[model samples]
Target: MIRIRLGARGLGGVRFAVSPVGAAKDLLRLVGFSPGTLTPQWRTRATDALSRHRLGLLAVVGGGGPLGYAPDFIRPEPPAFLTDINTGLHQIATTPQERIRYELAGAVNGHAWDPGSGHPPPRQLLRALDRGEDHFAHRLADEMARFWHAALAPSWPVIRARLEADVTARASEIARSGLAEALNRLAPNLEWRDGELLVHMRTDSIHQLTLDADAVILTPSVFVDWALFCAGEPPGAPAPRTPLIVYPAAQADCLPPAQDHPLIGAMRRKLLAELSQPRSTTELAQRLYLSPATASYHLQILHRAGLVTRTRRSRHVLYQRLGGAT
Candidate 1:
């Protein structure tokens, strides 16, 4: 468990910012990392984007691999100003020499990644790190930019609107109930006590820090399925940033048009696109050249995500896409 002792300055400066890159990176994790591993709801959503867009560079770099202990440089400190994906990319491209060396070195199994680690950074990524090449950073940023254009751009308006709405709602909650109550709602793993925010992590390790920064950024996430995340760079680690906590916003998979939500699978989106008229699962399956069971499974997922509604008409269970699962 980790505890953040909020100093008066920190307490007063609690603010909300939206992270385009953080959401984008974690979305890659949800879908492209491993199949049938975790967060099926969110994973299925992201699979749609990945299936439609070939993130060649990101895939080669193992950007979405099981690297829970990946370098903190990838997760830059949240800028005080709510940032766009380009801003996030600039920060990554301009990572300081010291931080690049420190965090990348820490990723080897013997370092912080040990005890629990994901797949090692791919050989190519490691080679770039070893050579201390700046091109590696630019390449990474370019890849992320490509990914943003390919996968995130089309749905960014919906995603950004949802994030803004979440922030507005949270601000209202803070106004109505108070900061302590608002903090408690971030995630079940968190609580407010004795001027400190207590985080009950699955890991047994305990950490406590006195928060004396400009602000503690409270960001809302759509890609993070279940857990709350707190990310901060250690002191003297490159450009310092405000500490950040990411929590799930309401209806995390609320994007509708089923065809429009990038978090869904490509196959499902195809099925949904065909659902301008009510159709049976078997009908959808045939239209998409898929098995009935496959169609039914996708339909069920769409139903659960509030993207489609089903009805029974005598013999067939007909499903149609919802206008907007907002």
Candidate 2:
């Protein structure tokens, strides 16, 4: 069975009905980081704060192939952040001696592969998923098993399994008690929705919470992309953002003739038209049929061209078509 859990040490709660791939992708979204193969730097960057907060970790695990059950799992409720249960799991699952045992066990079956060990790193695993590349997922699953075996089993499971259980139990009680009362008394701006079970941050505030979940599982680290949404200005307040694409107006004499640059010319026209109406990365990506990264690249080129300027309104950066020469 693909067991998934999302909670910290003392407070356990969030649960979800998702596939392993979905869980992994969701976690990646939360942390504001890209996924693909592995990278040396990724280990340091993703886990640094995890080390500090020692705050605990949440997991979303699932399996459907021969090794997993098919019932599908879902988080009946949202979890409260109290302690670091998942991180505690990592300590046991990723330790040296334990990792060695799991690695060798898998290696004997000719399955010992580490996506993060070689170049390209494992983030590509996710990149491939984004592109709908099937082979990549198969290859990733094969290697992912080995990676998890080495990184999370024997070594990390020892401590993680125990802590996760405790956290999950307490979280359930806290949620049953109606957290809004304590939450409001502590910080008035937060709101908890019955359906989504998410603690909505109405203002610039930080508060601790406890909650419950049905199943609990742990992944290695947090996904880094959620920051773009969670840390931004309050919802409905024009989400601030910088221009993703800039282009010099061909009519302006300063920019080199646009006759030779169709890409630049097209972008210039589009930016000019959109100058009055702001669009988000997602909207722009859909409109242009380009990946967010590709859109960002085009935007960077435009910024360098000086055809557009950026401004910060609250936590968001907005782009404006500037009347200037490149």
Candidate 3:
């Protein structure tokens, strides 16, 4: 029972992000490191890859950290938008030695094993951390980058679509009902009451705290399934500037709405071809000689099919083809 009391700054400061690093980390945990369960295809892919090559440092901290504590330094602070995995890996690679020492300490400690797991904590990289080696951080980042490309990249578009769809829906809810209302309904284990966000913990740990960060990062994960996870600089732990909460993504509902819309018309086909680069509907409309309404209608169909992804840039929402994988 962790009570995250949100002040006006915290409530008004809430933001949502689609984190590739987060999903990738959760996938690693779900498949082999933890009691988590990934969807069949994801489990098979991740498991096969893990069996083939040893991730060394990544496998050490893949579940984030030790004692069910995921370190904050590994994943860069998400900025309410989607970015490629390299952007995040760079952040991890350049993490300061002091920060890494503070955060990674708990992960490498001998007492950090999961309770029911038959195996001990992964501690092969501890000697490097203990020796105050800056290269250890880069090595960790390198392993994560390799693991993500090998195991997660193939299906990232599918996962990205699911994450963005959830964020889009939740953002809409925040717009309509206000952030307070949205928080109350974010997950089964969470509720924003009065000025506090109550997290019903699966563990017996109980505490009262304040949500006193610049922004609350809400990322949705397909691998997390029905679980709601909250992490921050808890109690006396190394302080993280922003608190993070991961909710279950709406995977089942992410795709196929455009199936009913269908990709039949010549207009849609042409519009899809034009979206190879990001373009606002107005730009697309003017280029194609179609009305903005006609352009938007077709673009919406393509977006729902997961073939294109839309992002708000300045005053306009730009759409780009997500790759031909769909």
Candidate 4:
């Protein structure tokens, strides 16, 4: 059995066990918050209200409802709108995603409720809160943009007024939260220490480790161990006992393909060579002396051409070439 422990440095001695799922649960527990099941009915209620308010697109993609807690782990593929909003928020906020989480209590939801003790400085708190509210407003703007682009493309009036009202209300809620020192500690906290498992958490997912029972537990942070596990490979080749099945062939007409620019053609050739084994866009880009984004964009084009395929292995997307597709 794997054993893990965590320590709180200040505000008196406090400790918690590190579970297999990692630190998100412990962090939430410290704040007296527990995860709840996100049921379809609750989703329907929120979606319905959102639709009525013309915020349906944002709500659906953003994921709201009774099970809105972190561990509920229901984040859909964030719509491009949400992604762009999150990117902008990250650029603007000091803490980014951690500052805006809300919870239900005292008949009304409270912003930045901390069951865990300790207060930050009043100025920092205010800044964090302001950043949080700004992040939320940007998210709302993205939703409005999408809604306007699709449902009301020809008109400016439908989304403009609603966008104004939503932003106003969101901003007003930020004002009501009070810029007090204690009120601002509601953001999730992260700590790393020696001899304690450090589990790096992203979004709602736990980073996992695949250490052998006899292997040394060198790192206290689960995240460190998780990284080690990812870096290690399993022993031995595939068993000969494994079966392979050949599928019936389908006919296709041979046609001349559109020509690619010289740069694009060279990039595609490099990608095909690199994809003989799965490799992340970043790694491939580094090897090819290309920027990560440029590599990724070209990889997508290669993917469309059936020269490559991508699978998400952990946080990285790994690309592989189809053996005979080209």
Q: What is the TM-score of each candidate against the true structure?
A: 0.68, 0.25, 0.73, 0.21
> Residues 1-326, candidate 2, lDDT per residue (tens digit)?
00111234312332211122322323222233222433333343334433343312121112111221111111111123322334322322333433233322332222212233332222332344354323332333443333333323322222222233333433464567654342222212223344222333222242222333332222212222111111111223232211110111112121112222334667555654565555555456677777877766776665554445556667655655543221
Residue-level lDDT tens digits of model 3 in 108-165? 4422454444555555766656655468778878877777877777657756776777
Error of 2 at 9 (Å): 28
Q: Can you tell me which runs of candidate 2 are displaced by over 4 Å?
A: 1-132, 179-196, 199-326
Clash pairs of candidate 4? 196-220, 197-220, 197-221, 197-222, 198-220, 198-221, 198-222, 198-223
* Index of the highest-TM-score prediction: 3
Ranking by TM-score: 3, 1, 2, 4
What does candidate 2 score on TM? Answer: 0.25
* Candidate 4 lDDT over residue span 50-115, tens digit each: 466665324322332222222111111111211232343333232223323321121013112223
Candidate 1 vs candidate 2, TM-score winner:
1
Which candidate leads the pack in lDDT? 3
Task: Write down the lDDT that model 3 would get.
Answer: 0.68
Pairs of residues clashing in candidate 3:
none
Candidate 1: tens digits of C-alpha lDDT, residues 1-326: 56667878779888888878877776665555444543454455455544566545454443433434445555566675478787889988888777667656655544333435555556766666665646667766777777666656655655666777788888899999999999888777778898887666555353444444556777787765444444554567655556677777766653433244655777776877888789998888888899998888888877755566789999989998665432
Count clashing residue pairs in model 3. Answer: 0
